[model samples]
Target: MTNPLPIPPVTLGAINMEAEDPQALAAFWAEVTGGTPAVSGDHVYMPAAHDGGFAMFFQPMTGPRPDRAASHLDLTVPWGSRVATVDRLLDRGATHLWDVLEEYEHVQWTTLADPEGNAFCVAEHPPVAGH
Candidate 1:
């Protein structure tokens, strides 16, 4: 019997920034993350390095949310370890958005936001065995 081919590595091409002003927002993130501008149908796309381990995109929002949780980003971290990485992120200016360190009894994730009030999280990746 022939063995099956291995799956390819996943690449994050882009993510939505949900910016109130996309041009300015892209410029800000570009300065922060060394990103560049990508072009798409009258919209300015912000390009992120594929190997940086996370991807980001920008879109102009007509208005802002009245409350939180209505807006957030879902980010994935490597399996079984988040401490060192999360600390590294904090050092880079990502602030704590919310903490579930106690209420949930299990801190599934520690939510965070960037300088522009966009929220994302740090969480453990579910185990993947026999890959």
Candidate 2:
């Protein structure tokens, strides 16, 4: 019998977000992540700053922001920089929700909302005991 054709890998290309001001939102993300932001047609995009990561795209959106519990971005930093990172993000127009380290007592992440009220988490995950 003939072998079936090999299946190709599926990868994520970009994460699309809706913002009141796509350009400004894109710029904010670019500044924070050190990614380059560019506009094309009706959307603003920031290519991923790391290899194997997907880009970020912002589209024009109006009206009240939706409930973000359904989906949110989780940003990982160094092993002990969660507090400092949360402070920096706060200084850059992010509103702190709560520090999970204190609230949950089992997590090393902080939750915050961007200037436009999009929820995201800044986390510090320790390296596993064995690779």
TM-scores for every candidate against the unseen true structure: 0.53, 0.81
Tens-digit lDDT track for model 1 on 9-128?
Answer: 987677766666666666655654567877564356765645664456777665765575565565556654566656766776678766554455334577877656777777765555
Q: Each candidate's lDDT (Cα)? A: 0.63, 0.81
In model 2, pairs of residues that clash are none
Number of the top TM-score candidate: 2
Note the clash tally of each candidate: 0, 0
Model 2 C-alpha lDDT per residue in residues 5-115, reported as the tens digit of each score: 987988878888888889888877876677899999778989988886569999988567666458888888888788887887778788998777755433589888887
- RMSDs, each prediction? 7.0, 3.4
Measured with C-alpha atoms, the lDDT of residue 102 in candidate 1 is 45
Worst 10 residues of 2 by lDDT: 98-107
